[model samples]
Target chain A: MRTARKPLTAAGLLWGVVILTAVLACSILAGLSTGGGEGGLRELLFPAAGDGDGTRQILLQVRLPRVLLAALIGGALTVAGAVFQALLRNPLADPFVLGVSGGASIGSVLAVLAGIGGTGAGMAFGLDGRMLFAFLGALGALILIEKIATVDGSMSVYTLLLTGAIFNAFSGALIYFLQSIASLEQLHDIVFSLMGHVPSTGFGTVAVLAIGILAAVLYLFLQARDYNAMTLGEEGATQLGVDVERVKRRTFVLGSLLTGLAVSVAGLVGFIGLVVPHMLRLVLGPDHRMLIPCSFLGGASFLVLADLLARTVILPGELPVGVITALVGGPFFLYLLRTRRTGHEFR
Target chain B: MRPALILLAILSAACSNNLQEQKPDPVSPKDGLRLVVVSPSAAEMLAELGMLERIVGIGDFVSRPPGLNRLPRVGPYNAPNIEKVLDLRADILVTVRSEAARASNARLRDLGVEVLELDTSHWEGTRQALRTLGDRLDLGESAGEILASLDEAMTTIRQRAEGSPSPKVLFVVGRDPLYVAGPGSHIDAMIQTAGGTNIAADSDSPYQLVSLETMLQRLPEVIIDTSDNGPDALRGRLPGPWDTWDFLPAVRENRVFWIDPDLLVIPGIRLPAMTERMGRLIHPEIFGDPVEADFEPSPEPGPTETTIEDSP
Candidate 1:
């Protein structure tokens, strides 16, 4: 019985990793197909010779960066969502659910309208001021909501969820007010920016984003056992030797960082965070050990596929990937809510 | 003789007092009177007339004309703060005509402010608006000079492209569903004046989507995409849908152009330069000789060049 169980467990882990790898590989292949040229997987994996050819230049410069960025954002958001859901013991938790995304959006909109991103003596580092402001805004929202939701050194699931909802509404109103004051051209930028279209950032920037996401995910995964115990109330987890407060604080900070970094790169890509975690939870069960790792893979694959559809559905013109995720995630979420047999309420 | 001279002096003084007591015309204010101006074009015109110092309040969006940005903003063109205008105790309020600002204009008039509405929707409208503004501000001679110079520049372009064949042009204002300016739009008028036929001119709406099927059928000679604010918009970034129709004359001949929408679409005193640019884009061969340069054309071979193989 022990020998049989050992192989079965090993097979399960291997199969899960294989499935994730397949999804990532497929998405990369599909992304390359949308480039619309003679080049295929060879050109996708390896850069073409420097012949100064226009087609190769477009493929190498534009589509590659966009696809890579989408994958990074998708992976980061999903991992963040998985971590939050585990920490809060709520399946419905997402990066945006805590108001971080909304606050970041407002900050970015303000920066764009004020024309803060351009290089000059006015702003240091020549970074898009909107992106920096968005980071700060996310941090601000996280701290404020954490303070309100935490009572007696313990985070309440109910308060955290409620605060997030109210803050989301407030941020939406703030964005609209900023829009009213924006110029016609600035309005276009703000609208597109909010719709979650990942523009082509350089490979260097993508590398930086990848490193940030990986570090956050690794940190969260290290405390996976603590998250598993927290699923059984904070008092119970503490009795079982889990430092519930420390885990909650660390998770919130790390998760918010991942969220802010993703938003700064890819705007607000909704549904990936909410949908990916739940979908992974259904397969992997409530264990964060498996859930967190699988969520990253699932989210990355889902966004890559969604982005492929976004680019190809209205071919030549692109639909914002956020719209596609909402269309797909909304019904799936409702289905999950409807088919619940257990008495466990989602926070 | 002394009594007669004293009586004449008293009569002359009475006549001068009567002239001072008479109220100025409400519609047209007297020249050299202090007034606050709103609207960037109006502010620019004021500066052009050497009357910037007279402007006490300017619109929020008026950043151009050098010194106007420093002035107190009276709000945007659509909604100028009437309270500020009244508080400044200005003579008149000038504004541009748009559907959104109609109510604001009515309110301004109701508040006893002399409101002059200018329709700066097209080149002709822009010229007429400038002239009307000049008439209102009592800068008639300067307005006449500016209008005459504008007319001369437009006439020069018209004469240059008089007998040349008009190219079929597609002017895209926005992407996604292919929004283009139709008849009754200033862009359409500019395209016509520049010796090109606007393919979207027959659409019902002023700014409407010209179906992709219709676009493919029309096969325009020149495709001018104003979606981007700069020159590189038409190059490799022509989006995806258009790539499928590489056989179209515009694509095959590398006739696609990208120009700043503000310069071409915005109705202002820059119409002359706008028309000249449009003419060059539509028929560069007519204005100047075509030069052989390496252009990164679309990779997909056009339908005209593609061959179908028979299957056994």
Candidate 2:
């Protein structure tokens, strides 16, 4: 409805992408420039006269990978949230609203309970058992929710939403049961994993997560026009020569893939998914074509900066990035809701 | 710290089994005046004072002083069941100082129970706690003897550690989020007395969740990791996870140790023994190499008679 009301021009879309990309670049620069340690962009720009391996290691080995991971997770979660909102035709829809994050959390909690964490439990290409199990949990939850929601040969939006809500509640209860039995040290790991902090990972893991998230985002981007058409209603989309059911199924799968990749690596970094898409939609309108790409870049910038604040706000001790995101995003979103004109396009 | 609070809430909530039991009429104290010791460290102190038979109930986390096993568990240390404590007819309830359980302890006191909140988290607090508990229980002579032995043992340890190099040490309490022992903690005091500079001495709190990058930058020479609690978690002088950070001096020199947290975390009469163990781990040349038992999870306190004199 928003796209139909306001025509999106090619030039306007280009300008939006360029501006968001510039913002993302700035955010990444800031993220790479500062950290909890001495190694930073200064070391990279002007090498000391003496040995600088430690500084380089801090920059490259610690901060660089963390920045990249945050960017990727942010982008993936935002894109997934935007797509889910379009498919569900609900402004409140988020990547985690469909129980995928809860599934990832259960897997993560179970892994910690079994003592399968730390950088030492390396399984493949810097992927530990915890991350692997989280991804599998997300995938399993997707399959289970899909099966429960599908009726005959079709999936109903209302049924899908309800199934996801119930599944998430169940997952939460199960995780609590698991936590009850966990040792104090294991309990610490479980709580941190759920609270969501971007860990300093190897480049191999970042590269792998990047490829997976980008491919899913690309697939969803291909269906942007279909999403725009569906905003009119499912029947209207079908009347406009769109394969409504096929597009819906594909969007569900691709969006869920993005959410899974993010939750598996970074735990449950909240608010970015729920807040960024709406913020971008208010600025760029609900044209999925522009909204998808801009949301990715804007969300990437948002989280990179939030993570920077999370690490630096208390000097040597770092807060969970999720805390920063929720603290900033929740109030901003509430303010936007309170001040914005009623029945706005994004709302 | 926030996570620890969440964990405390979870543990408190999980101790719901006792809540389901019938709340029988609150029984008045019997002639014997039984004691319910909710703090594991305090229970260990009571056992050391030869008052093990006096404890009628224990908090959930208390595992030491095996004689108390038959006693009914009230609940976790932070959220003991008041009904259960009353049912056991405990005239005196001894618990550790906790901000979270302040209201519960207050309510217990209102209900006519003599609640003794002890601070056994540091050496001085433990000494004071022994004195207070001894005065209350009329075992002041035994408490004095225990304190004397502890001071004598600690003085010997400090004398042995006088000239030894103070290697930079990292006392890891939890690994995934990198929780460390910082200033004001018993572990921090032990690290200092045993001739090692705590890497987290500059941290703002006693126990802090710190950045891994900052920890690496500090370059600790000796790492005492009591973080892993898995049944098959690494033990002894081995770099299980620290090996990944090959650049760390502790990893390079093979000085990364995986120990049981219970051995050093609980502060009580074992401060001297725990400090001696720390001395062995920190300066083996003078104190002798840590024996196999040093790395194991000995939640049970050693024999009371020889606790001060025993050495690896």
Best by lDDT: 2
Total backbone clashes of model 1? 2
| Candidate 1 lDDT by residue in tens digits, A60-105 | 6556777787887898889888887777777667778778888778
C-alpha lDDT score of every prediction, in listed order? 0.66, 0.77
- Shift in Å, residue A265, candidate 1: 1.5
Write candidate 2's Cα lDDT for B130-219 as tens digits. 887777777789899989988999998898899878999999876766778877777889999999999889887677768877888888
* Local lDDT at B131 for model 2: 87
C-alpha DockQ for predicted model 2: 0.32
Interface RMSD list for the candidates: 21.7, 4.7
Regions of candidate 1 where Cα sits further than 4 Å from its true position: A1-10, A35-53, A106-136, A169-195, A312-316, A326-347, B1-37, B45-56, B67-71, B89-93, B96-152, B158-267, B274-312
- Summarize candidate 1's per-residue lDDT along B42-102 as a digit string, tens digits: 6656665666666777766554454555667787666778888888777767666544556
Q: List runs of model 2 lying over 4 Å from the truth.
A: A1-15, A45-53, A96-100, A111-122, A132-174, A183-185, A336-347, B1-31, B298-301, B304-312
Clashing pairs in 2: none
